[model samples]
Target chain A: MMAARRGRSAGLIRLALYGIGLVPAVVSFVLGATNRLGADPVNTFERTLGLWALRFLILSLCITPLRDLTGVNLVRYRRAVGLLAFWYALFHLSAYVALDQGFDLHTLLADVTTRPFIILGMVAFTILSALAATSNGWAIRRLGRRWKALHRWVYAAAICAAIHFILSFKVIRVETLLYGLVVAALLAFRVYRAAPRRAKAPPV
Target chain B: AVDLAAQPGPLSGEGLKPTPLRDVTHYNNFYEFGLEKTDPAERSGDFHPRPWTVRVEGMVAKPRTYDIDALLGRKLEERIYRMRCVEAWSMVIPWIGFALRDLLAEVEPLGSAKYVAFESVVRPSEMPGQGGVLPVLDWPYVEGLRLDEAMHPLTILAVGLYGQTLPNQNGAPVRLVVPWKYGFKGIKSIVRIRLTDRQPRTSWNVRAPDEYGFYANVNPAVDHPRWSQASERPIGAGGGFFGASRQLTLPFNGYGEQVAGLYAGMDLRRDF
Candidate 1:
């Protein structure tokens, strides 16, 4: 009975987290479509989406740390949350292509080539794409042991995303520092949690 | 409320689309209020621009402070200038003001003066962003122009924009308007003008000397460390979103004909 109740609550939590995760991106799109995004609405829309994508990527990284450190497990919804990050990142790129750059291939190429931040963002997106493509149960079962190893690269994606944020701004603000610190702490926690396990195992 | 047709302009912005007041007032980079575009407009509503005073000092025969109203009493003309930001966006604004020389003439700058430094008014209460978590640059922003650039007829201390008294977001009662340089060179909410032989240390140049120079002439050939400057999105051109249209950025923001004589053989690529 307790297991059933736990399952029910987990389902609700999954639905709730997914619903919450979608709010900013949807609001940005709604604002853009309605022409209510103020002056430079295109930039507003694109930046808002990009920020949320970075935020979601950060939150997705936090989940494992939260479970390990605090015993508050949201593991059931982690996949969906991870997927939301990908969705936001996808929209962010789409906004840049369709709205900000206006399908100008030359400008887009210039941006990707000249800006190191853009290059880092592209790398992060590629990593997220790979993880997203193999997220389903079918891919999970088919790939077997390799799937977990592949998905673990999300950590690398988070680092790239954080670096992208740092490099993107002309002036790196305190918010960027704070975000960087959070990513660092999350990675540190992973290393801490792995240390004892590594101590017990044979040396690789 | 006045008609656009009656406004005296094209001394700078000829054949360029004027950025609407909505975009002008809303889309800003006034770090005093905030780095974000909307921060100044929303936050500056209560900012008291009236009862302001400007002090002209340093190497001048006579230094004095004049009330804002007294300065505005001079013959003011409307100049539609194309303002380009270092961030690679551009705007054509109808600025109303008299030549900076008129103001400088009143003070009688001494022969020792080779550069004129401009400083913005810094108040934590008035400028909401200063106390914020991450202010972009130092307070009471300072910018300098070479004496020749300062004495240029086109260099005006703008008092109004779009034929209306300047909004608080647009620098309120007083601001410097240098047409050829990037927008940051036009330090806003000005309170102090200093004439000196030594080159003045500007806020952005002090912050990142490698990135922002004292003479921030708009040069398309030179790219900012992070971005391209070859093309720009004029604010009103409907090019910002999904990039529909982008015009090539002009040398010295198309004021090269008027101001290139000032740079005269200086490599803007290195100087930039």
Candidate 2:
């Protein structure tokens, strides 16, 4: 009975995670539809989705650290958080293509290839798409150990996302700086955790 | 707010629709107040623009400071201009002011004077953005124009917009308006107007020389380093649905007929 109750609570927590994760996208849509977004509604909407994508990506990265540091295991919900990040990123790119670029494939292609920041963001998104595609139980079971290796690219995606965020603005805003710092901290923690393991590995 | 009285000028926006007054006043890039579009409207409450004085000096025959009220006494005209920002946004504003040449004429720029530099007011106490630990751009925002550009009839010192006193966020009391150039060239809250022999350094150019050049003319051909300048989103148009709000950015902001002669033999690609 205790095990069943624990499983039920975990399921509820996962459901809650998804519920909260989707709020920003819904709110942004409603705001855009209602003309409540500020003067530059399209830019505001696009930025809102991009910001949430980066936040979710960071949150997904924090799962392992939080479990190891505090003994609060949230491993079951990590996939949900990662999928949320992918969905937000997809929406962000769609908004840019539809609203900002006016479905101008020529300009979109030019932006993705030429603009350094846009290129970085697209690179991150590409990696996210691959990871997201293989995030199901069947793929995980089939790929086995390779799944862990492929999913590890999330760090690279997070770093690219952080740099892309920083480069989007002309000036270094405090909020951007804070987000960059968090990503940097998370990356540093990953390196710190990996150092001892690498040192302990037997020679091939 | 007291309304500003002015006669209609020769230049008119007859067919063009002026951006909604709400968007015009609410969205701004006055770094003195803050960086965000809404920051100026929200944070400019403490700013005081009255009882201001603009000091005219440097390479001019008659160097004298003019009081803001005295300057307002001059003949003001309502001129509708389409202002394009370097960030690919545009707005049509109905401004009330006299030609900048009229003010320059009063000071009598010397034969050696080839450029006109404008400096904005800076008060950290009233402007919170100026008091930040690390500033985004140099304080006392500065801008410059070639003597010919400054003397152009299209250039005016705007004191009001939409037939009313300019709001604090919109560069209250006084501001520069160069219709053919990017909006950043329109420096605000004039504290000093100096005539110089060589080209004066502009704030944005000083910050990012490669991206924002000295001659920030609105040319669609020359793209900003990061984004295309081919089109601009018209503020307060079509509710930004399906990218329907975008319009092709015209060369020299569609004022080329009147201002293109100023750049006669110069290569805009290099000057830009």
Candidate 3:
């Protein structure tokens, strides 16, 4: 009974966090669609959504640390946060395709190929899409240990996304540099934690 | 003196005021101060405008210096033009200024002079963005034009906009306004002018030669490395559907007739 109650509470908490995460993305989209943003509204909207997507992805990555540090055991929220991140990322990609490119597949393909930053972003989104698709319980049960291995691709996706952002700006700003540093730290933390545990266990 | 209120045709229309221009100009990407679009406006407000002087030298029969006050005393004209940014945004502005040709004639360029190079005022203390971590272009922004382009009637030595003295954020005292090229071609807060036989390196081109070429012409066919120049969104048009629906950017910002001849012989893709 106690275990079941704890599971229910965790599920509710996960739902609430996912709802909270959507606020900025939805507001930015509605505001962008309504023409409430400043000059160069489409770019502004696209950038806002893209940044939120990255932020949520980073936050979802940080959940393990937060759980370990606070002893709150918030792992249940990871999937929800990850999914929300993917949703925002989908919108961000769609905005560029629909508004900027006017659904011109040729131009979009040409841009993705010519621009290194755009290519990086596309690669990250592709990996993220794969992860999001196989996130269901049936897939997880079927794949078993492979599920964990596949999800590790998130780390690569995060790095690619960060590089995508860094190269986008003409001159790299402090805000962007700071975000890059945080992403680097999170990645470094995961590697540090994983390596030591594996060494101590004498090769799994 | 340039009477902005008396400009001909569409510019004289009631909505064609300098406020929007001022807003856009004041808020800009003067990379010497910093690369961010808004950095120049924020950091440049405290710039001291008094005691300014423009030194005209190099390849000139008579090298001379003119004080800001005396420079403003020359014949001024109001030109309403569409200022297009290479970043794919644009604004229509009524500029109050005298012809740059008139200013060049004052110095009297030598027969061999082929290009006109302009420099902006550089003061790091007042411009905080100058202390940024990134290695942007050197201080004192520099812009240049071919001799023919420099002498073009559309190129103006702008001292004011909207019938008012230039606000600090808008490159106060004096700046250059070339209607046909991208906004960066018009160097701001200019303090130096030099006539050279060789083509001069512009600020943007110096920083990223691959991205920003010396010509810097506004050609819709030639796109920026990361984005397309095919369209632009007007300022204060609000975001989302409202802006997406109304903003229809025109090639050469609808000034092709006035300035297209300058690039007739050259392939814009190579030059741009």
DockQ of predicted model 1: 0.36
Which segments of model 2 are wrong by more than 4 Å?
A197-204, B238-244
Candidate 1 residue pairs in clash (backbone atoms < 3 Å): A98-B242, A99-B241, A99-B242, A100-B242, A100-B243, A101-B242, A101-B243, A102-B242, A102-B243
Model 2 vs truth, CA RMSD: 2.8
Residues B1-272, candidate 3: write the lDDT tens digits: 23333233232224543435535655566665566666676667677877899999999999989998887776666777777888777777777788888888878899999999999888888767667776666777889999999998778888887776776766778999887788888888889999999999788898888889998887777778886666665555444544544244565667677678878898778988
Give lDDT tens digits, candidate 2, residues A9-40.
98998889889999999988888877778788
What digit string (tens of lDDT, one per residue) describes model 2 on residues B76-141?
899999999998889999999999999999999999999999999989998888977657899889
Using lDDT as the measure, the top candidate is 2
Q: What are the per-residue Cα lDDT tens digits for candidate 1 across B1-272?
A: 22222247447566766887788988888888876778888889768887899999999999999898886776678998889999888888988888899889989998889999989998898788878876678887999999999999889998888777788998988999998999989999999999999999999999998789889999988878777788776675543343335678899888888889998888777889
Model 1 TM-score is: 0.89
Minimum summed lDDT over a 10-residue window in model 1 chain B is located at B1-10
Error of 3 at A150 (Å): 1.9
Q: Which of 1 and 2 is ahead in TM-score?
A: 2
User: Residue B130: error of model 2 in Å?
Assistant: 0.6
lDDT of 1 by residue, A20-66 (tens): 88998878777766656766667678778878888888888888888
DockQ of each: 0.36, 0.49, 0.49
Selected candidate, larger TM-score, 2 vs 3: 2
